[model samples]
Target chain A: MSHSRLGRRTLMLAGAASLLTAKSGLTVPARAQGLQPTTSMRGGANNYRPGAPIVDRIGGGGFLMHGTVRRAGDGAPLEGVRIQIWAHTTEGRERDARSHGATLTNADGVFELEMPQIVPAFGQPHGHLAYDSGAFETVFLRPVMDSARDASLAAHFVLQPA
Target chain B: MTLKHLRAVIAWGGLATLIMIPIAVAANSEYLQYRGPIYIAAGFAGIVALAVLLVQPLLAAGLLPRLPIQLGRVVHRWSGLVLLLAIAAHVVGLWITSPPDMIDALTFRAPTLFSVFGVVGMWALLAAALLAAIRKKRWLRPQVWRFSHVFAASAIVAASVSHAMLIEGTMGALSKAALCAAVLCALIWTVWQVKPWRGVRRRQNSRR
Candidate 1:
C-alpha cells in the first residue's frame, strides 16, 4: 500500500478505537459537569435520616470536615438539619455498596464528616455534602480536596426558610 | 476421538470460555460484596447480556464451524430468549435497589450519561426481540422486516456497548472493555458481510 493509503487506514483505525473507548474516560457533558446542589440534596432511602450519627460510616483518610448550619435570615443555628456526604473512594463511585448515610445537625447546629480518599481513576477529588431541614431550603456543598484536608474545615452552611 | 470430533470439542470449549470469562471476573470483583447480592446479580446479568451479544453475530452469520446452520439457528433463537431474561433480571434488580434512579433512567431524566445509553439499548433490544417473535407471521414485507431488524440490532449493539463502557461498576474494566470492543467489532463485521445497506439502497432505487 502507498504511504498515503496506509496513513488513511491508520486514521480510520484511530477514530474507531476512540469511539469504542470514549465511554471509559471523562465524557460528561459541559452543562452537567459541575456539582448539582439542588438535585444532589435529595437523599435516598438508605441515606436519608433526620438525626443519624455519621462518624462510624465514613472511611479512608483521617480527614475530617465539620460545620455548623444556620438560618440565612436570622442567623440562628438550625438543629435537626439532615446532612448527607458521598465521594469517590479508591475503589470507585459511591454505589449502594458504600455506606453514605445522612445525618442531622445537633442542638448547636454542629456536624462533622470524615472524607473518603480520592481514586484518581474516579476523576476529580471532591465531596458532595447536602443539607436538608424540611423547614428550610436545602443546601448542597461541594467541598474540594483543599477543604477536605483541613483539620477543622469549619464549613458553615446557611439555609433560607421554605 | 476422530479429528472432526476433536475440532468440534475444541471450538465448543473456546466458545464456552469466551462466554464465562466476563461472568467470572464480575463475580470476583470486590465491589460486589459491598453492593450486596441484588446488585451483584444485576451486574452479572448485564455482563451475561453483553457476552450473549458476541454469540449472536456468529450465529446469525453461520460462522460457528462446528454447529450445523440448522442447529445454530435453534441455538440463536434460544439465545435471544436468554438475552431477554437477563435484561429483565438486570433492570428489575436495579429498580428494586433504586426506584427513583430507575425511573429517571427510563424517562430520560437521569443525570448520568450512561443511564441514557443503557435505557436506549434496553428499548432497542426489546423492539428487536418483539420483531423477531412476530416475524414468522409475515405481517410486514420481507424488506421492511429485514430493515427494522438490522436497525434495531445495530442500535442495541451500539448503545449497550457504550452503556457498558461508560459505567464504572463491579465488572473488571479490562475484561469489560475487551468484551465490548469484541461485540462491536463482531456486529460491524457481520453487518458488512450481510450488506443489508446495499439491499435497502437497491429497493429505494427500484421505487424511483
Candidate 2:
C-alpha cells in the first residue's frame, strides 16, 4: 500500500477500535451524587438589597414585578414588607456589587420591582425574589419564570405571621 | 471487488459508525428526557461539538485515505466552521436555560471546576477559529500562525477533555471517555508528526 493508503487504513482501524471499546461496557465507578446543584439553581442564592438607584438602572425590556404582600389568614395587604428582586443579566449576577439592592412595600402593602432584561442562566429563563417583614414569615421565591413579555409577574407573598 | 476498494468501504463505514455514537448517546441520555427543548438542544450541540473534535485532527493530518490533501484542507476549513456553530448553539442553549451559571462560567466566577475548564476550552476554540480566519488578511508569518494555532489547539484539547471528563451529565460514561481519549491521542499524534516546533526553531536559526 502507498504511504497515504497505509495512513488511511491505520486511521480506520483506530476508529473501529475506539467504537468497539466504547461498546464493550467498561464502566468507570460512579461518583457520589447530589453535591452539585442542578445547573439552573446554581448561584441562585442572593442576599443583596435593591436600592432606588439600582431600580432606576433597569432599562428597556425591563418589567415590573408588582404585587400586594398579604397576610395569609384574612388576605389583607400587609405593610412595610421588604422585597428583594434579582435576575440574570448579560454581564454578571444581578446581585453582584455592580447591581445589588432591595425595596419595601408602601402603606397599601403594594411593592413593585423593576427587573432588567431576563437573560436565562443555570436552568431556564427565570429570576429570583424574596419577601421579608419583621412580623411575618420570610419567603424566598426561586427560579421564577420571566413572564415579562406577556404581562408583569404578580408574585404575591401570602405570609403567615411569625 | 478489488482489495483496495473493499478496504475503502470498510474504513468509511467504520468512520461513519464512530461518528454516530455521540449523537445516539445524546438522544438517549436520561438527563435530557425532562429537560425541555432548550436543554435538549444544548445536549445535542455538545454532542456535535465532540463529534467535530473527533474529525478535525484526522482531516488536518490528511488521514482520510480517500480524500486528497487539497480536499482534506477544504473539509478541515468547513469542519472548523461547523465546530464554531456547534459551540455557539451549545452556549446559547445553555444560556437560555440557565443565566446565572452561564454568567458565572463566562465571568470565571463559577464554583465548579468543570465550568471553568469548559469556559477556557470554549474561548480557546473561538480564538483558534478567529486566528485561522484572519491569518491571510493579517499577513501573519506562517511560523507565527502555526505556533499560535498549535498552542490554541492544545489548550482546546486539554481543557475540553478535562471538562468533559469531570462532568457526569448526558454523555454515556464509557463512550465519552473513549471518545475523549481518542481525540487527545489524535491531536498529540498529529502535532508530533507535523513537528511544528521544528519550523519555529529553523526560523529562529535563520534569523540569528
Question: Which model scores highest in TM-score?
Answer: 1
- Over the stretch B73-156, how does candidate 2's per-residue lDDT look in tens digits? 799999999999988998898887666567888898765677888899999998899898998886767877888887898898
- Per model, the share of native interface contacts recovered reads 0.00, 0.11
iRMSD, per candidate, in listed order: 6.6, 9.7
Docking class of 1: incorrect
User: Candidate 1's residue-wise lDDT over B1-208, tens digit each?
Assistant: 9988888788677667766777788778655544547756777788889999988877876766677778877898899999999999989988776565578678887555778899999999999999999999999777678788888999999999999887766667787787888789878887887776655444544654
In order, the Cα lDDT scores of the candidates are 0.69, 0.69
Candidate 2 TM-score for chain A: 0.56
Candidate 2 lDDT tens digits, A1-162:
535656877899999888887688453437532222112234445433534233444444356667767776566776777777766543344545443446678888898766554543343345666654457656656555533243356666777767
Shift of residue B163 alpha carbon in model 2, Å = 1.3
lDDT (C-alpha) at residue B59 in model 1: 85
Residues A1-162 of candidate 1 have per-residue lDDT tens digits of 545655877999999888877767555565543322133322222223343445554666455557888776457777877787664454334453453655568899888766555431111234556665477666666544543223433456777667
Least accurate 10 contiguous residues by lDDT in model 1 chain B: B199-208
DockQ of each: 0.07, 0.06
